[model samples]
Target: MLSAGNPYVLPSVLVAAGAYLAATLLTDASLLVRIGLLAVLAGVVPIVLNRLLGGGSADEWRDDPIEDPGDGGADADESREA
Candidate 1:
């Protein structure tokens, strides 16, 4: 039921729950390992969600030529005056 823009929210919530469960249930593992696993889940979950949502690769915005001001080459005027 979640929208595409909010796809990562569910995964993030799940990761938090999983981390809490691991801490409570797995007493033998070191704290560092538990933290590392949580970190990996946090990083990977968003990427997977984004891919599933059909997000495009990041792109730089470029202005269209039609949107530019038609200044009529002011530098040419300056050179003529000089």
Candidate 2:
């Protein structure tokens, strides 16, 4: 049950950057105001991004299709013993 359509990395980075920008640009705003806006942004960004990104769960990655290649070892390792 692997997923091939959920590319959430970009959306997360974008949302985080947006939140950080929103927090950083409020230089004259009060501390409470800054905290509140940051809090709301932190809370809302993931939820929106999740919905926008198909809302898959950890289970969706259980059976990764790409096989592991043993730490990118050299061809010699293929014949060497442990």
Candidate 3:
């Protein structure tokens, strides 16, 4: 429906780019520390931004659980039986 995968591509890239730039500022920090900053920022910031900004309709973005109909397929043969 919603183009299959990663509807937040642009926001993700922007967040990642910003993370890279911010991580680069820590020139004296160890590689692992810089990597950790990038990992957390790149992974978490985009989703937070999206939720805070209300980037799209709540229905489109929210992950609500679907309710199953009570009938299921049990009624499929009811008319034929009558």
TM-score of each prediction? 0.43, 0.40, 0.43
lDDT for 74 (candidate 3)? 65
Candidate 3 lDDT at 39 equals 64
Q: Tens digit of lDDT per residue, candidate 3, span 1-78?
A: 112133454666677677677767856777788777766665665566556765554466457657555785467668
Q: Per-residue error at 71 for model 1, in Å?
A: 32
Estimate the TM-score for candidate 1.
0.43
Candidate 1 segments whose C-alpha is farther than 4 A from its true place? 1-6, 55-82
List model 2 lDDT by residue over 19-66, tens digit each.
667767856777676666655555555556666667775566767867
- Model 2's C-alpha root-mean-square deviation from the true structure amounts to 6.3
Which candidate leads in lDDT? 1
Q: How accurate locally, in lDDT, is each candidate?
A: 0.63, 0.59, 0.60
lDDT of 2: 0.59
Mind sharing the TM-score for model 3? 0.43
Clashing residue pairs in candidate 1 (N, C-alpha, C atoms within 3 angstroms): none
lDDT string, candidate 1, 5-78, tens digits: 54575667687678857776977778787777776666666667766885433331223354544676776688
